[model samples]
Target: MEKITLYYFLVNNKATLGLGENIKLLLEDAALEHEYVRLELDEAWNNKKVQLVKEGLYSGTLPYIEVGGKKFGRTVPIMRYISVKLGNKYHGANDEENQILDSAADIIGDWFESAKLAFNGSNEDKKKYVEVDTPRFLDIFERYLSAQEGPYILGEKISYSDFLIYHRLDDDMALDRLADYPNLTKFVQSFVERPNIKKHLASLSK
Candidate 1:
């Protein structure tokens, strides 16, 4: 088996933070020996990113990740595939667990997309989006957490789901909604402080 490689293309910013950080952290937590190659976006990548998006090499989205020369367009899918391949067991041990994890990841992805609109759109539009859409998303995640006992979404074991939730909250915090979910806030605090995560964030900041 050839050593799998990951090429991560991203802008150094918050919009891509959730997926970007989740994938980066997941790789570290899993302790997979893979190279991290970034194609820092500039005017140059605009054409290429667009081309890749059309080719299904990327979603033309930030935090573009390719593994083994094949691109996985979205963050959660990328994380899920890597977790399964590395046998990290963050997704779940059984089929039921995997389903639950997948559902949780989907919820996070939805919230992230909605919140992106809130962050980037006009003030009036942001207000309307948050008022009309944000709470419902938050409510669903709160309910999901209510069913789990954790420092993690999968209950007591930190899986890719926790990483997704953690980074989403952090990325979404700027939009003023993340503080509403106490369980998520506490859960994120617990894992984000882990040495590897702290190190990763620190390195990125520098």
Candidate 2:
């Protein structure tokens, strides 16, 4: 088998909350052997992107991860791959549980899409997103989280999806409605306070 490879871009505003960054956070927490590579997002990277395509590495999208002859690109699939790769404990117990988590990931993807509008859209659109879309998604996550057994999404178990959820909620200025949802707020705090992840997250800032 060939060596595994993964590549993804950092989020512009909150670098730490990026999909690829979360993967790095997990790898660090697990004490895994990995190297992070980043190129200046300028003409040099533009030329390099073409080279990656020619070399069968670029998928034209990010969170592009491949391991053990398999590749995944997209939110949920990438999380699932990383979850299983990290350890079975970071994944769902059965098919049904996995499916439920996938559903939650779908919601997260949609929620993030709306967030992008706030980041790049006009003033009116941003206002609409803040007043309408924020509560719509937060309410759902709040209810789902409240119904769970404990701090983590899988209740007592830590999953890769939890990291993704943390970033979306942690995105400053965009997802402010999180405070209104007690469960969601508590979940984010728990993730921040986790010993290994907390240390890992602090490292990213420096």
Candidate 3:
């Protein structure tokens, strides 16, 4: 099999902590060979890596990916594509469950995009993003989780959606009361104990 290459356009820890972390975890869990090359905006602009940026700028933003000499933008699509290729036991075992998992994955992608802007924006914009946007986003997700059964968004087996949601909630420190939603809390807790993810969590401090 030809090696798959992936370059994650990231800045600091925050960038890696969210979607970047999700993709990395997914890839590792699938035992898929990959690489992460951080894209430094300043260095790229100054050093004329803009062309490379442009090529990866399918959606004109970071978290973009280059795979097999082709650029793929948008997070969920990439995640799905990789999951299908790797034959990972994510997205669950059936069609209905897979759809639900995919929908939750979309929610996670939307929330992460909102967060990226919120964190990168000016103080005023940040306030609006935090106060207005986040609550709305979280409310939608909370309901989504409420509709599900225990220990996962879809219950029982973990899915791609779980990885995305768990990473966002845990990394952002946005969910205040996990106890309020016991199932979601337990789901996240279960993942937190996974070997690959646990190792990455520890590496966050270094």
Scored by CA lDDT, what does every candidate get?
0.70, 0.69, 0.68
Q: Who is ahead in lDDT, 1 or 2?
A: 1
List model 2 lDDT by residue over 1-206, tens digit each: 13445576655544554557656666655666655654345677777667656767546556666666555566556656656655665678988777767777778878888888677989998888878887787788788788786877788777777776776676634445566788887787787788888887787689
What's the candidate order when arranged by decreasing TM-score?
Answer: 2, 1, 3
TM-score of each: 0.76, 0.82, 0.76
Per residue, candidate 1 scores C-alpha lDDT tens digits across 1-206 of: 13445555554543244456677788777666666666666787788777887778635775556555666766777777777676656768788888888888888777877887777889997887757776776677677776777767676777888787766656655234657777656666778687777777677667
Per-prediction CA RMSD (Å): 3.5, 3.1, 3.4
Model 1 misplacement above 4 A = 1-18, 40-43, 50-62, 67-70, 129-132, 174-180
What is residue 183's positional error in candidate 1, in angstroms? Answer: 1.7
Q: Write the per-residue lDDT of candidate 3 for residues 1-206, one digit (tens) a residue.
A: 13455655555635465456677777766666677766555755544445655565644554555666776655666777777766756756788778888777777777877888878889998899767886676677667767756576776666777778877886667656465666566667787787777776787678
Worst 10 residues of 2 by lDDT: 1-10
Tell me, by TM-score, which candidate is best: 2
